[model samples]
Target: MLNKKQTNTIEVSSDIAQVIQDGQQLVAYMAKDGQVSLDPDLAQVMIDAKYKLQKKQWNAQDEAHFLHSYDQLAKAVAPVSMESIRAISRSDNDKPSQAEKAVAWYRRYTLVALICLLFVQVYYLFGHALAHDLKDLYESRNEWHLKLDSEEPNSKEFKQIQSKYEEVGQRLDANYNLLKVWNRIWLMGFSFGSEIPPYSQEKLNVELRRLERAQADANALDNLNLAQTRLTARLQLFENMLFAQSVLEVLQGYVLPLLYGLLGAFIFVLRDLLREIRAITFTTDSEIRYRLRLTLGALGGMIIGWFLNPQELSGLASLSPMAMAFLMGYNVDVLFAIMDQIIDKLRGAMAANDGSKGKSIQGSGNG
Candidate 1:
């Protein structure tokens, strides 16, 4: 047992086996825990050991041994990483103070309330602008008072008034100056021009002449039928102008704001998802999931902006886009939680209703 050659041979084999075991442990730990440390000689020895292992036909026991080591490494590191991500400290694990809980709740609820207020404001501003536009249109049209309220339509006085109205209408149509008006509208955002005559002379002439002959009696002249014709003309003019102004208002109040919010939402979602993937899975590529989250966030923001009426809330409508952006960025999880609760309630209600219906049907059958 003490022969020099045999003793040296045994020592060399023991050293080789130690090197192999160390290399295996190092690689398994590094793979699972994302840590590495090596000197040049040690690194070389690990590489050589790994190469030798690869050449050998490993048994099930060999595979199990490596897997077990990996599992141990993962378990050791996972809690630390998770705790770091979640911001859970030793104090948090213990009983939280009432003051600490209150502060946390205050922060969350205050943010939610502000977001809701911002939504209200956006809708209010949009609605206020629209209402103002409509009001102006109504006042401007009413000032025309184009109806010839005089009793005798065939009289010289009535004819003279009618002729003057026609002249003004014709001049307005001919001198519309489309380029000038369009430039003004583009620059100023809105306008009401008399270029498009609210009432057509041909229709006015026919209605006036018809009413004059058919409703010639003193009482008939006072009847609302004559006034209805003038109202119709006014309505047509208002309809045309409202259509144009509505398009402008919608673009400014809804479309542009929604686009800005969407852009903000997309960026926020992408960044958050990328950070999550990096921290948790490190090697996972989540481009599709990121894009999907971005799209949903953007669309959700748009829907919130759409429902918030600016006119009703007036000054508050100014905050709509900002609120929507905030909602997309931070409040999305809270919103989803709230939505889940609502859905659950609705499902319960529906089930209850179905049960009631079934009971009623049974009672009816017995009766």
Candidate 2:
């Protein structure tokens, strides 16, 4: 609402105030021993300007004369003084507006939300990995069990399978301990009254010992088979329970990529926001843009997860889908650029197809 003349007056006033303050600080700096040396004439001019400014009797010409003297003194004594004055002037003029304050307030809550979301994603990811590893161990155990069934109890192959099975069991026990800890800390409520009872590693070990003892008795071979079957069934049930608790089906679909994308976007936003705050360049005007960027990042991540197969790409074969999603989210311009390239390729292919169709029709008509 401020007109040009009023804005100019305000600017001049601000500049004059800054000049006065800087003059005082420069004089103080010069007073300090071995700090700075100013030409006598320039020093006098600075003193006169400071006096005039303090008395509020400085005209435009007086202000200009003082600025020229300050510049000369700065060049001779402290080269950085002029730049510091300019920075101070900028800082004074660019005070945070109401909108910026509001944005800052909202950003605090946004930060909290992002942190909470990050914790959840990390928790789910951990659970997913644990469940997956446990499933692999269970499958390996099943394979070894099959091998044991085919071998004589006292044979080398049987002993080897038994050894491998025990190793797998030890790993399973370790994983079970981890699960117990995880459940104790995170799933206390779910654990207390859950319909799916927790697996007992101690009972499983007892059953295994019983099976090993009965393996030498030919009459108890059927009992051994039954015991193995029961163990396999229990292991399978535990695996299912783990996968269920992990929400593996949902995570494997699109949620994981979305979460990773959000994480990437959050990281990028936090870094950018901190930089802007440090630089004193952050404004509410860009807040909406940041939110949009975050949304785009999440979408980019989901898109990458759904369509982009890293294994299919030559150099990207080692990167996982989640990693790709995160990268896309962190820098959505990359995703946009990639999509543009894909669109161009599709358009070119369609054009070629259309041209070929036209040529074929013309040939048929001529024939």
Candidate 3:
């Protein structure tokens, strides 16, 4: 039958009682270790707070007095121990502040964003694998064409090369079919106004048919070469299109770097959050600051990718662009420091150039 206000008061009272109990236990341990000797006035406040809590006379004012006394008592203990006690108090309290609720929401949002980035990375990996397979197929087809050119028509070696060429062609057709479907899905919105026209399955089929006919005729070397040339050209076009899609559609300059940066920031924030929670130093302010840090990290990653060449950095020359972006995002300060150094060096070089120019002018005047 408790009203909302009464229910909240009851909850607050329970939370205060738990905090006071924990404080008392910590104080007792500190006393045993000769690290604390509570003031008489603070001791009396604790006694009164306990008596009121036990008698169900607890109220907001009593809770405040209890908290103040607990703080004063804890001041004598090690800072780390005090923070641990506060952390426990916050953890036990069921009611959260509005800011804490907002932080919780943002934390979930960051996690979701990270998961989306992971999916994109996996998709890119699949595309890269497909591209590699296509490259190998193209090379195999080229090798067969070379063998076909050198071998005499209708000979056993020519027949063997022709059979292998047909097998490679079949594999290319299957791969092209898969690529078309993958392109549609992967490049859905990004494929508009592309210079390379959509590869026609009909054209591919016709060329394949002509190649088959030439193979059957055996003596039609000109027809065989023409069909092989057309088929190879078609495959090369598909390879170029796939490469463009990977570069322009999937990994548009800043998109991957931004995602990598965000992932790095998320990791750093998550680690920091855990550490702060353990130290009982996490607050609404810290949560808000972390949100801004995440943004800066993403931006830092993109900037590093755009402006900072990995080759210019001594030890970091081995890192890929994406890897560099991640590192920049995780610690934007490093990027900033590097930028500062570059700026300073540029300024120094300019100053030296200006000084030399002035000396040359002075020498000419003397002459």
Candidate 4:
């Protein structure tokens, strides 16, 4: 129990052979219970008398001295409220950068790159697919020619025509081939400003001659009709395929990965984002949840897109290669649009909030 009027004495061993009167400024404070005490060196700074006398004895306001410094600490600490305020002010002024700005820039760049990469990766794969489709079309046309050679198209209906041929197969393979060739030539021109490959020149020359003359004596010329039709169809398919191939080559080689790099930036940025979230909060639940959801959604869409495989679908359903191409193009367009929109939305969501500022504000307030 403490009594307000009582001045409790702290027993000091007066056994110092003799008191150094000069150092008498040092005082001891005893608690109201009389037994509890702290030495000046170990005491709460507010009660150190030696430091106080040291301040009072010094005439220099700019003491530039440890004695004055000790007294100043004692004086400042004597008032708890002032001490608290000074602490807060110091905290407000002190700022160690968290590297968040750099991280944010990385995130932004990554997001932008993700979009470009999405288009790029899709284009790359689509181009590879297109080249494969072109090859298939060419080979199929060759097979058709062999079939034509084997079959007698008179009287009896053509077996495969009756069964496999349809509205799709009706499109001219020759025209498609021509279109593909022209595209290839244009691509070559763009790349090196050079002529197209000479590999198919002989076939191209023969096809051109037949095309020029096939217009005359339509019925009498019918003897060579099947051969011309087969050749022309092959040309058409080749043309269309060549164009698609060239486009894919450019996109895949030059554009896709470049864009992917951007997306990879996003991928990397997001990783850091999650790390930041975890670092700040000491938890990964939110980041993991969002990332899992995002990954699953993207994977599901890719799988769904794969279901629209043009090759098997075209073959089984009796669609022409041209029609199949159109169908695939349309489907891919729709899918790309959907995926793009979803990505845009996700990035928008991610960009919405800045959580770091709020944490700093609270820290400052505490300080």
Candidate 5:
């Protein structure tokens, strides 16, 4: 009976034989002398077959066959001029170097960011347009007259109405202003929700009656009702516009940034997965190390994006554009760094506060 090693060798031999049989046509085509020219079709087939074989576990015999077949095909096609070789759009063997991969990833994310920025630009445009529309709506003689009659411009009641109106308009405009890049960038939103009129006739009438009482304008009651009704309609439109803008902000701000962050994290982690899991702090494998660095850098970029994104009170009201997306995709690391600093500051403040409290207690005990 054969020993274990001997049995394994026999099995390997059988596998090699089977491979050889399977690749009979490939071998025959390559080995044929003066019969098969390096025709483009044959070249393609040889390359394909060679790639498939390389993917499998090959014994010495299989390796030998591969080398021989490859050499034969190479020699067969040697006479074919380089100019005659058609450029293949893509190939499995065409593995890009680290630098090439980096450039490719950078470009890909940059392009994605640009697209997001474009969407943001449109969003801002919508905002600016909406602002203008609202102004126009409020500017009509009937609308203006009703507002004027309800309360004097300088009066507290009139001021309250003006304040509320300006607050909404300014919120929209402030978002646009904050979003501007070098005082030039702007954006807009796509209305994504159904328009629902906020004020019913009964609601408007009640509100108008209250306004009439505030002004005691029994003579202008009819005009005030009409003007208030119009105002309600405009406010409803404003709400719809804001809803649409918020949806886009969530997509561009939260969803896109999160996806980008996850992508970068996964890519970086996958590159050094084995080594990272293996606990090899000092890596000897240059390829693995390089991949790890590349992925980590990408993830870092994503973190920075999150940090830079407006987290201020007015951030939600701001436009989410392609520029922000690009920043988020490429500078995610910066964002993380900022968050780390904030956390550290908070920790320090808490420690100081605790120390102060301890001192106070000590002083009290001494007294």
Candidate 6:
């Protein structure tokens, strides 16, 4: 039942507004007498606000009010540079200020996401292209096969082609033999046929044993043929063609979902990365952020894939691109909620560490 806030509006209660105002006044006063140092905590709050509010679209009045309200406070923060403060004040058109930062982030974040997705798409297209190119190259090479169990080939070229197919067929047949025991098990357990007679369990067990023995025989034959023919190279090429097609079907059908998954995960991770980067201090290490990004991205890929995976792409089962995009968007929002929780945990841990160290330092100095 945990809930996460997507926006940082904070309700801005009268008390908090007063706090911000007083903080602003304190910063301004401190700036005047060569005592320009700001309370780092107050500065950090403003910096946090900048990042938290960057997602929202603002207007000229909002930007102007923000600067007018806290420009001094903004100047106090460590990473909250003068350029950031000036950005708030430069234009009354809110689009160019905080709002524009959000837009720029959106654009850049999306571009990075699309790049990951494009890799998935490329994986499929690349396979198909390679298959076609290889097929053409083989044709041009005029590849020929030598026949072993030649059944009177119609012509030399036909015999070679037949030999190739026959070799593939033999491998397939051998593979089927290896799989026969599994098939027998399936048949005994659930084949579509008349009901088994009484004591069928014992009968099925016997049948399976018989199948196992048969499979061993087939495997022995396959080995003998393999040794005799030395057709491993040609057979491997044939197998590659079949393997590539099988792979194509999988990648082609699932590529869109994979794209969605990868992009969704990237979105989930990137926001956290930005937050972590913005939050970095002498205490916050980069390794933690990187690992955190990976963990969250992994979770996002699973969660997003679960909810919005492209299940079926043919006929009425197919999803429109807009729908897919929208679903991905919805998942991103959920991912953001998860990110907030992680950030909160990180902040809590960092705060505790600081408090414990502060007490230890004071105790040592007193001693």
Top lDDT hit: 3
Tens-digit lDDT string for candidate 5 (275-328) = 432232222243455455445544554444444545452753374533344344
Tens digits of per-residue lDDT for model 4 on 113-132?
55655665655565565567
- lDDT of model 5 at residue 351? 100
**Which lDDT values do the candidates have, in the order given?**
0.50, 0.67, 0.71, 0.44, 0.50, 0.51
lDDT of 2 at 134: 71
Alpha-carbon shift of residue 349 in model 5 (angstroms):
1.3
Cα distance off (Å), candidate 5, residue 85:
24
Q: What's the lDDT of the predicted structure labeled candidate 1?
A: 0.50
Q: Which ten residues in a row have the lowest lDDT in candidate 1?
A: 80-89
Candidate 5: residue 33 Cα off by (Å): 33
Where does model 3 exceed 4 Å of error? 1-93, 97-103, 189-236, 239-253, 306-318
What is candidate 6's CA lDDT for residue 246?
69
| lDDT of each residue in 101-178, candidate 2, tens digit only | 644655675576467667767766776666667768879888888888999999998999899999997896676666
Q: What are the per-residue Cα lDDT tens digits for candidate 3 across 1-367?
A: 4465455454454566687786766666555643457577877777776676676666676788788878877676645464344433434457764435544766887788788888777767766666667768878999899989999998998999999999997897676655555566645644433332346545655666876876656556566567656766675556555564665454646777889888889878877877766555565566678889899999998888656787876898999988988888899899889889889999999999999999999999999
Task: List TM-score per model, in order.
Answer: 0.44, 0.50, 0.62, 0.34, 0.36, 0.30
Candidate 4's TM-score reads 0.34
Off by over 4 Å in 6: 1-98, 128-230, 234-258, 261-316, 320-326, 330-367
- Predictions ranked by TM-score, top down? 3, 2, 1, 5, 4, 6
Please give, for residues 146-197, the per-residue lDDT of candidate 1 as tens digits. 5445436788876776766565555443323332343343348654443424
Top-TM-score structure, candidate number: 3
Error of 2 at 47 (Å): 25
Taking every candidate in turn, the Cα RMSD to the unseen true structure, in Å, is 14.5, 11.8, 9.9, 22.9, 14.8, 23.2
Q: Which ten residues in a row have the lowest lDDT in candidate 2?
A: 189-198
Q: Tell me how far candidate 5 lies from the true structure as C-alpha RMSD in angstroms.
A: 14.8
User: What is the C-alpha local distance difference test score of candidate 3?
Assistant: 0.71
